[model samples]
Target: MNGTVTELTVPTPEQVARAPKVVLHDHLDGGLRPATILELAREVGHDLPADTAESLARWFAESADSGSLERYLETFDHTVAVMQSAPALTRVAREFVEDLVADGVVYAEVRYAPEQHVEAGLSLDDVVAAVQQGFDEAVAAAETPIVVRQLLTAMRHQARSREIAELAVAWRDRGVAGFDIAGAEAGFPPTRHLDAFEYLQRENSHFTIHAGEAFGLPSIWQALQWCGADRLGHGVRIVDDIEVAEDGTVTLGRLAQYVRDRRVPLELCPASNVQTGAATSIAEHPIGLLTRLRFRVTVNTDNRLMSNTSMTKEMTALVEAFGYTLDDLRWFTINAMKSAFLPFDERLAIIDEVIKPGYAALAAEGV
Candidate 1:
């Protein structure tokens, strides 16, 4: 009750809601529409606590927002349980992009663990193909075209890093843009997947590791020093390594300085952070400080359905909490575009010709 006024002078709600944006850390499994989940559950006879989309959406948000990683992850059990077929996977992937497009995201890279979908007796290749087809169809069908790519993920607790990395490289030209590993952070460090990281690097491929999340700098250090990640998926805990003094002076630890100097992008999901206990709340999060320090911080929705969030919603929360401006939103979008796994020329075109122009048009019209 600070009179709904913010200390940071953030942007208005309308500005954030309408800003053109880019997303790079979304999970396809985590973004299945709640209504879609109900339909698929009906097909497979998967019993759910809520038969309807509204109740299910509430369940997901409540379960995830409980501030426990284990409970947050349990919600995915229901989502993954329903997404066991090719058509189901394809439909979810397509709708994921359609939702992004509707949220003013011009470019996005959606990711999911192929292993999670194979319980339907399909091979990893089949799962990848189905999801890629969905992305293709969605982009083609959009009135405002969305540039979509896939990031194949390996479950961290499992031992399929090398295999999943190969899957990513195998589908490299087939719409798969990069490799990633998700799940537990402490025991399943990227060092466990060094061979995968080495292969991707030697193949001149890219990957993002879900580090510095539930775990801390050790997780991030392994992803960077041991595995050589191009970007960090939810590397929110890096803030733990940085210190700001009473006199407004900043001191960066060795790890933070290294990451900042290398321009390693941080795919920050503010709402999801609060949901998963990465941040206590949006206002106390280090996103504002990181942005001020010029870290390559990119906003994202780690999971739209699970977190009950969208890119616009994430930006809106940041605006309310930190008082970001339209320029700040624009800068976050550009940061995501720059940090994408796309090639330099293609990434540049997306930003220069597509993202900037789109934003400029909005600004020109005073939208």
Candidate 2:
């Protein structure tokens, strides 16, 4: 074994795509296929800025790259507009699962606001059922086993937090896995929906808050302390609490230390962070430091379409930027699977049976 090359070769894009991945923070409205968006737009008589899928895709990327949270979220208007009906919702949901399976995702928790799709005369229950039916159909047709669950989200700036929290509980056993509050974190804080968080907690349910992305530490502090978030969505801004001196010594502030010690998972979306101006570049992302510190850091695709990214692409970028090998990828995958809102036994099962074996095989192959 002397003078031997012991390092595992960096995984190729194909191998990375084939790796078992767990997604915890994806948005359903933000991950639609560009062509599907066009078709759905026509079905709903909705006008889009671009006529073809390619143009529409570019428009989404450019729009989201504007570095303004409000502008970035406006791109969802078209996707949500076309998803108002049951058929549209079902189709999008089915295709979402199909795409995830194709991208080699074994388990995913996709979140969306039920109230956003209710403009077409569908009750909240109907909306949830339609999406669940789509997921069921896709999973049935998949050649490889894949599990997809829903996270019922309420707009933090809205008044239906209680209603949405109740809907999540109603469908907890059906397809919904948990609850969430998502929206701009600046003006509308997670504490605005304290009632929803309290309700979920009273029921012994779990939830994540979209915090620390566009805003700073206060947003994350409020989400965790006041709102009782089980996890922090795009908790990237927690890096503000971390200071590295010029002498190369690192110090963690109280908040950062608490997040690490408490094992709170940070759903870090590298590409999406760059596109949204949360991080300057992939090389400068806090994920590098956070991962080094061994925080419960998990990689994700916050918005697949807008970011124009997939799990493979996200992993590949991290590999190139951070010199990550298959083991590092496995670490992130296990973190995500562990942080998932699924039952502890189910999460452990995936980590042991699916995720570990998948990465181990890749390592054995030296990729």
Candidate 1 per-residue C-alpha lDDT over 1-367 given as tens digits, one digit per residue, 9 for 90 to 100:
1222222334556656666789999988889888999999999999887878899999988888876777887898998998889999889888888888889888899988999988979999999999988999999999986789999999989999899999999999989999999988877888988999999999999999999989999999999999999999999999988999999999999999998999999999998888777788889888988999989999999989888889888988887887675667778888899999898999998888887776565555543
Give the alpha-carbon lDDT of every model.
0.87, 0.91
Q: What are the runs in model 1 whose C-alpha is more than 4 Å off?
A: 1-11
TM-scores, all candidates, are 0.95, 0.97
Give the range of the ten consecutive residues with the poorest summed lDDT in model 2.
Answer: 1-10
- Candidate RMSDs in Å, in order, are 3.8, 2.3
Over 4 Å off in model 2, which ranges? Answer: 1-7, 68-70
Best by lDDT: 2
lDDT of 1 at 1: 12
Candidate 2's displacement at residue 276, Å, is: 1.2
Name the lDDT value of residue 362 in candidate 2: 76
